[model samples]
Target: MSRKLSPSRVTSPASASVEPSTPRATRTGRRVLAGVVTSGVCLCLATVPASAADVPPVVSRGVTIPAFYTPPAELPAANGALVRTEPMSLGLAIPGLDGRPMPGTATRLMYRSTDSAGQPVAVTGTYIEPSAAWTKSGPRPLVAVASGTMGQGDQCAPSLALEHPLTLTGDTVSVGYEALAVYRILATGAAVVLTDYVGLGATDRLHTYANRLDQGHALLDAARAARKVPGASVTAASPTGLYGYSQGGGAAASAAELQPGYAPDVPVVGTYAGAPPADLTSTMKGIDGSALAGALAWSVSGFAQADPDLRAVVEANINDTGKAALKDASTMCVGDALLGYGFTKSSKWTVSGKSVAEVIAADPAAQQALDKQRIGNLTPAGPVRVATGVHDDIVPHAQARQLAVDWCRKGANVTYEPVILPNLGDKILTNHLVPLITDQGNAIDWLSDRLSGKPAVSDCWSMPLQP
Candidate 1:
């Protein structure tokens, strides 16, 4: 049976929406993006079921997503209240449609969270309670898995990807590769909560791709929301850990720093931030002419979404090609983006014939926005495990190392691990992804120990970084 996603009526601050005057809201308000504010469009799903019709359905629909995702007139100020939820068998999230029994129970959840401008918004995600026993910890441990670069479209949300893995970015062999990490955390009997970020999953709003603070808010709030989920045994005292690689890594690291002020009540014990793009300015320059150059387009759109001044600057500097590329980028997932703009240079899209990096560096407003996105300004409250491949080209390994150095200087307990892989001629492709795969199991082991009350020792003393 074809089903739709329906909104659950719950009174919370996020349900009461208001005009967000933030830079992102202002720009989004002026434009008519597909998911941002659609008018009664019914988006049908090509149903993929978890089991044969005879077995109870693991997946079912509630209401049309385009209709359910749009923000309401008044959002409640309360953060992290469950808005709508539907019980989904965990197998529905696994790929290959194999009849293997699910490892746990999952609930597709829509919850309340604040956006970049501090306005309440409904954010969607999944709360999975693994059937495994909590063998090594006090109170059930929870891990909030932040996703890497998915895309700006509503379909790219992690919650959706969990259900229909292959369609997320199109041409990916193992669309459910991310599930490996989730399953790793689950193997330890720790429940996992995966977020779709602010606009990607919960609302039709343009995903504020890497708006640092906003991503941080979404991550921390996901931890808060997990406990309140029905049928889940989690509680306020459950120890929490955060894990994310690349874009997700940035969110995890940002949440670590922002936790003290943004969501202090969240008892985050450890954070594993692998190959995080902590410094956007340096990262943009590093990946400038690489195969992943489309990332530049995604980054600018994200900045413009958060700050209007940057949007105005973008409007003034971008040429027709740039405008079209931006418009095109707003609708594409990561796979489509790479294929469409692979190895493309930003200089070709600008009016003045300067590289987009150069243009952003020169403009004060753009510079400020980029600077704000950088991690390490504040120290993480608990033990932090930082991993970086020595040859990482996309997100410079130096910046990742610097994150550990900076946190150490601030008296944070930091364990810095430099992933030393044998040389592959091209550092861009292999270097960035290899560490995520190779070191992930160890990272999970480290986090599991932390949740089990094992004290973390800072490794900053051994790996000295240049000033």
Candidate 2:
């Protein structure tokens, strides 16, 4: 369902709200997008036995699109709380038909305040239940996940919706499946919170690229919101630990950076920043606009999102196509952008590109795209940990190393560990930047250590020379 997208626009970042179509409080959860539902979904053949008519009856009510960007009417004070109610949907193999039950479920989650600006942007996320039903832990900790980028702009699959296409699928085909992470974290009896970022999911601008503030705010805020979820059993005070790989690592790192200023009150005791691209320019230059060329899309999106100047910059040089692409990307969902809406191959439509990047790069406007790469913003307020592969390609080991160097130099209280990774190490992790993240081993164990009230380990070594 991915769509063509480009990058342009910026305002530092913020949001608002009107009388919502649905009640602020809904039983199933509120999503920002309108979804079509089919009846007779056959949710569970076992759950719904055939009736006298010998046919199962299921209801499929098209899900309502909740908001473009869900901003709380009232934001949290610097030390107060911000709540984001996320509406979610499940994955469906078949489109809805009369009386046919759709494949995914509709649910909502509440993410508390976590923005430095105290803006109440409704963060997107998916629910991670145990794959194996119940062997028995009393209750699970809520795993508040921060995902890597799909690209920048709304046209890139948005992260604002609770139900993401990738998150709903159990099978491995899902590109962003973080199911393993979710399962692993939840197997320890923890709930998972997968955020889709500020403008994604719903019909807002797609902020695909790499904006650290958006990343950090979306992530930290989700953690706060997750605390209020019913049956979630997690609290703002719950022993919390964070796991973010790639852009997620970037965001996790950013969230850590924002802790002292944004959500320092949220007890984020420990965290894992793995295979993160800590710098933007270096990462883009390192990727050399090759197959990881997708970063170009992200580059433009982030630059446009980081500050308003970027939008003005790109507008001067971007062609009509480029401008529309950037604007559309900030608001499109993955299914429409990456998946092709089943009308064509995903490759058929381009969300961003050489033409645009070249335009921006060759000119100062293009450089604006590169300039906003989310590097150079590492100043962690709490304990920090990092993990990275020695042979990473995409986010490149060098950039990861640079992040370590920059942050350490800034006295970031950083913990850096480089793993002897293989070519495309670690399952070629769904998100290309995973190898740079240093927080890879014993995820559950590490998170548990933090949730149990253990402090983060701050160990820093001289920045390993970059490749």
Candidate 3:
């Protein structure tokens, strides 16, 4: 009750207005609205409370959630096995976003996937079949959407966020901004599957936030699970694409790289990664003293979950303030984090009297752990479109450009689009977030073309971005 919530547009080419994270407040002083909606009935349902009796029942040795989230003890040895599925509806309503109910059928799946340790783990996500028809060329495509930074809490899962728009942790609520992107993909008449990631909503373990292997495994498996969903009418041979921004973008990128070796059965045609934090080490340094500083805490906690060596390092150096901040971040969604720790320097939390980035750089084990989370090291099996705002400070425009350079060097075809925006000094929200909104439509359109068997024409040669 006290804390439980977590929470893009492309602007016009002609004009770059003030960049707002959400919608801009009207003259009447109402909160800015997220511009995504269509006509439909609201079939919203109540979520079961998070009480002891209401906790999801355990069906396996390590799996548990609500009854809807239970996994089978006799799990399939193969990855992407559909353990259980139930039909549900998607209602779109966010405080800042203008959205309507997108009536669709939801299928809950329990599939085998690898965790951070490369061990088999059962992960759950939902596959949705929208009522729309596939008017596009080729068979109806399937999109696996990796949500942006939702939070580290189970209540912050995108699956739960879609069902209950009011889900929030602390003061920040899950506004379902990613829901807008999901609905946008749904509008294309393609069936969409949204992954809850490994531990965020699947089990009681801490979600390995931004862990490349775990995020990639969950994403690829979601596409595999979609095929087994009854009545989705999507087959194993269906053209599949990946859509995600920010954290989701990193997952999509990792999935693209891991597909050739990990899950060769799922034919992924294309992937769109917007503002992906492909290089975690640089990203940590870039965001240390910024509005999204809480993300640094999340990243540290994530590495700790996967690497014992890194965990030992963190425990040894992190002071009491840092420890408390990490604990609070474990249960917060991005919304809560934004309001709670915006613009606070990482130095305040550490005992070394240095920033988190400096602390990590000073230690070899910690640096190695952070380096392992970097994406773009391997070549993607399919065409990829990477979008980054030129003035974006949160993810760093230079690192994103460098991702294109790295991918092209490995012979992977890439379409790099640096969103041009007016320089807004000290306006962190607009510079970082505007490109996410402005380039979204273009990213989706590009992926749609690839999903329909259209060849991607990329400017693969690396060029310097204008300052």
Candidate 4:
């Protein structure tokens, strides 16, 4: 989800392209790549609506954010309760085609969702009502998209990306890469809801990156809030599907596992989790010296936000370097992290000269906090597709594969796809990112089938036999 990009690569809003190389390309792979590239290019040309100028601006971590992102002092008692909403502008538009924007109408919204501690927190997201017609069986279905590793800054919020897909301000760099998936789903005549997770958009707190409960609840509640959007075509009867990769894959997987109990009212039909960080401990180790090493700071900062004991552990164990890195990372987006902290060692930030993972292994409280973040303990309720890059070392492939294996053991309907590609490189992010593009077509098609009321045949029986 985090791409290493230079400012020249994204000169203007329209210049961004979804053009990643597919290693073992197939006809379908070529088609999927072309489709996403076309979709991204078209959307990049989108102009902000006139109304966007009238909305007041709010600032977060020195970056001016939209006023719509500011939450009220108090929240509703119920989870998934709508707080506020406003008309949003999608950057892309087709001029000659009825004057309406291509893809759909966008709405920026804030809703109530429970935190890891069961406290009601306001969450922000964007809901897109597709202009295309649903050719499938049911009423226009809803797909709740959880974005992958957008960074910890409020300015990095995915909802903000709808208006400006790519931003380069001072040292911060933010890209709405998730838009490709959103646009693809919309092209199928399905409504899309993209959650900003807990604090990514809201000004009240720092983003709790990779927190399972917070992210899962935010995604499920987004579906509930989307239904309440006054003009949205989606209703309670709309079948819901979850989609995400990397960090988002973890959220989608968490949502599927939590849906049965957290938001039973939301009917989640299927889930597409690509390279989910199922085991946070293992994931932390994988990302430590990798290109996206800043993510380790995000995890530490996020865990500290939710757990007081873990916070205490961090405060006592972390040195001045660790504190500054976490502080810097808090205000940074993916691109900023990639530029400033890529391939940096986590051991440099600690007092004991041990990596964050090593420190966590030594401390019981920190280990317990991270243990709560693991995703495969519970069975996901619906048919779920788990895809992982065979060569991915950033989030790591083995942990992702284990998530499917764990779910299969629980008897949950599951489809496991191992994207076998040559190792693009080590610690550079190519191996981690390519499969997200290569396998996306099959992932979308699988979810489409579930939304069409087709029964999913679980490959759990064969999982044990394959690697």
Candidate 5:
């Protein structure tokens, strides 16, 4: 039996018709690129039942999340403990020429992980066991995939995306854009585990978007939990790799750094962190008034959820408009955000008409909380490939490059690749997203080499000279 969300939870201001100031040419180009990518994947619009028997569904941003996402009352003491698992459906697969299904089988799972506040939390994700054999030298490798900016809503969980590649309900829109990469990885006979982060799928709390500790722990714990899944091919000896872009890139990079002490048992051979949002201060400023401007509210809401000091600061300074925007954005997915708040300015949400970044800059406590989310402070373990588009103004190119630079200085083996492409459009997401599509093949090959025991050649010695 599915339960309806409370009236308070369902109310949102996304219905207001507000269009962004993007030029028609830029919008057309973006749509064409997006369509080409979507069509290429042969995405199916079929819907699977989102509820389990005797478990009530939870609603977020007007979308119904499966009951399997509900956490048990008492969690295990250890991190990465398996809470539950259910067979999942993949929307991107087709009947292969050989009469076997393309890609592989999927499992929707919930696992135990620690939050940014050091509290026990449930993280949801999907695990794909490839049908293809591991042709490489070692046993079947596992790649822990962290999705780019999906959103703060529970419905935006990547596990849910495996079941429904595209969701278009009233006022809510979500696309499983990561399916392309996941299917490709599966084709290589590598098992893929996709983390939904700390709170995106769990019913207990709101998603702590981009919280370094929360996201990093969730990702590493997913890798840990994947090995424990019943009948899974992945084992303790499996070579693990971390893969992500944009917000996911930060999480993967954070996991790589945190794995040395957090979960040294998970053998992470390599990490591909593309266009990581390493510096929140820079990223927040870059995202403001951009196509995905609603992300500002997500960052603030996430920080507030993890830090009480930041929450207090937010409550004191946010105007009614800001409060409404945050409330609305809390339930939004990336597509909903794009439609509802594209090119929206953060200055409108503040009491003093200052952007969220400016407000955080003024407050010592808020600045400190955000500083804690910064990556590149610690050296990442194992080989890490950091790639960024030279024209990516969304996450910003310089900060992502600086992460590789920081790791190189720390004596970590780092391969830094600068993707030089013509600027598609400024602040329209084209400049940021195009490189992700263009550089994805190279990134995958780089990680595959490391997984095959090929030593990575570091370009740290020449990084200062190139950029």
Candidate 6:
């Protein structure tokens, strides 16, 4: 959730910008809702529980809670064929509205796989298998995606876009960044893999901060998992393509870079990353003074979950109220990241020693801690296509540019494409990331082409970032 690339404005010549991740359940896209009611974007529906004990597993719709989660006996070996069976059971909400909003639960289809923890994990996503009763082509392409943000819980959270009350006059579900992109990838003759990411949909206490290794492993694992479907087997690594924006962009970049080392056998060809937050520190500075404080708060909390040191740093900096707020902040969605989002709106969160900022600023040990979470030093295993909005305020162009510059220098074969988004005005600093909403189709198409084995136009020149 704290992983918005925050590129102010941008696009790639190979492709324009497009976003495919979101708390997508309620926050990542940064729009509280997709409706036109508000002037700017809002992070959409996020789940909130009536109580903290909302951790039951397999809450089948209209049935008793299956059981409290005990890690699965073992993840199914993904080295098999693909097929669809009945959807697995899930419970989303409790019927009473006694001051608590309930999210409904339903059985969803999933592709299962293992993780670094060797835990049996699964992803509930969509795809059109040509081999199924619905195929016109032979061996459809595969598109595996890692979603952006969805508040970090299974039972409670906001509604997805389409289901959100903030619907702007559409019956369509506000598909999240990954879900939305899955459709695009599928449209291009590929069966997509939507990785809901850890701590969301399933798993616990994980949502890497643009951590490429995590993103790559999760995405590749989904591919192996896909074979678990009723009639599918990815016997050999097919010609695969990757695309993502914002958090997903980071995931795509991460997966692309880690393909050779981590998922060595997974055949990954072309990769497209739109408005990725390649540079962490730069992104934080850009959002420090914006209304996007909500995004900042979510990212910080999520970051803490992944990097304990950072969490301790944050804990030391803030006061009791700040601590409570940060705790609550982790549970918030874009909507709640409102006018005076707890301490984010207050000047205290921005200040030091007396607050979380001070804790970070004063911590001598934090220096070493901070360095671990920093991305951009790694290189990709294949051709990577990258983009940014020249006018993005949320993810400053300078940061994206710096990231591209950094990776290029590190010898990653990056197809770095930079383009300006005109309609996205210059006033609001964050409106930049918003372009992925209105101005990012090309980026999606570029990825499709790359995956299709189309050659990309990449340049390695260094570009200076603005002070």
Model 4: clashing residue pairs?
46-91, 46-92
RMSD, every candidate, angstroms? 8.7, 12.4, 13.2, 12.6, 9.6, 13.3
The local lDDT score (0 to 100) that residue 357 gets in candidate 1 is 82
1-467 per-residue lDDT for model 5 (tens digits) = 11212112222223111123332211211211122122221111111222344344555645766677766656777898898898887897777677666788888888999887677877889988888888988999999999998987778888888789999988679899999888878878899999999777775556778888988999999999999999899999999999999999999999999999898999999999999999999999999999999898788877665576677667677777877677678778999899889999999988899988898899998898888888999989899999999999999999999999999989999999999998889999998999899999999989988888899989899897865
- Look at candidate 4 and tell me the lDDT of residue 412: 98
Off by over 4 Å in 3: 1-65, 70-74, 93-103, 168-172, 425-427, 462-467
**Steric overlap count per candidate:** 21, 89, 19, 2, 0, 72
lDDT, candidate 4, 1-467, per-residue tens: 01111222233343233333321111111211122222222111011112223323434334677666666656777787899998988876454287767888899989999888777777999999888889999799999999999887778899988778888876678888888888888988899999999878875555778999999999999999999998999999999999999999999999999999989999999999999999999999999999999998888877775676666667677777877677667667899899989999999988999998999889887798888889999989799999999889999999999999999999999999999999999989999999999998889889988998999999988876766
- Identify the runs in model 5 with alpha carbons over 4 angstroms from their true place: 1-56, 96-100
TM-score of each: 0.83, 0.64, 0.82, 0.87, 0.88, 0.68
RMSD versus native structure for model 6: 13.3
Task: For candidate 6, write residues 341-456 as lDDT tens digits.
Answer: 52244246533534333355466666555555455667776777777777776666767777777778887777666765564554354455565655456766766666566676
lDDT of each: 0.72, 0.47, 0.71, 0.80, 0.80, 0.48
How far residue 180's Cα lies from its native spot in candidate 1, in Å, is 1.2
Measured with C-alpha atoms, the lDDT of residue 409 in candidate 1 is 92
Q: Give lDDT tens digits, candidate 3, residues 1-467.
A: 11011011122221113233322111000100111011111111111124323332432211123555433334566888876777655556222222433445666666777787766666777788876678878888999999888886555678877776665332345556777788888778888999989766754345678898999999999999898888778998899999988889889999999999998898999999888888988888777777778888777776665676666666667777877677667656777778877787888887888887888888887888778788878989789998888877888888888887788889887998889888665425567777878898999999988888999976775455433
Off by over 4 Å in 1: 1-72, 89-101, 168-174, 465-467
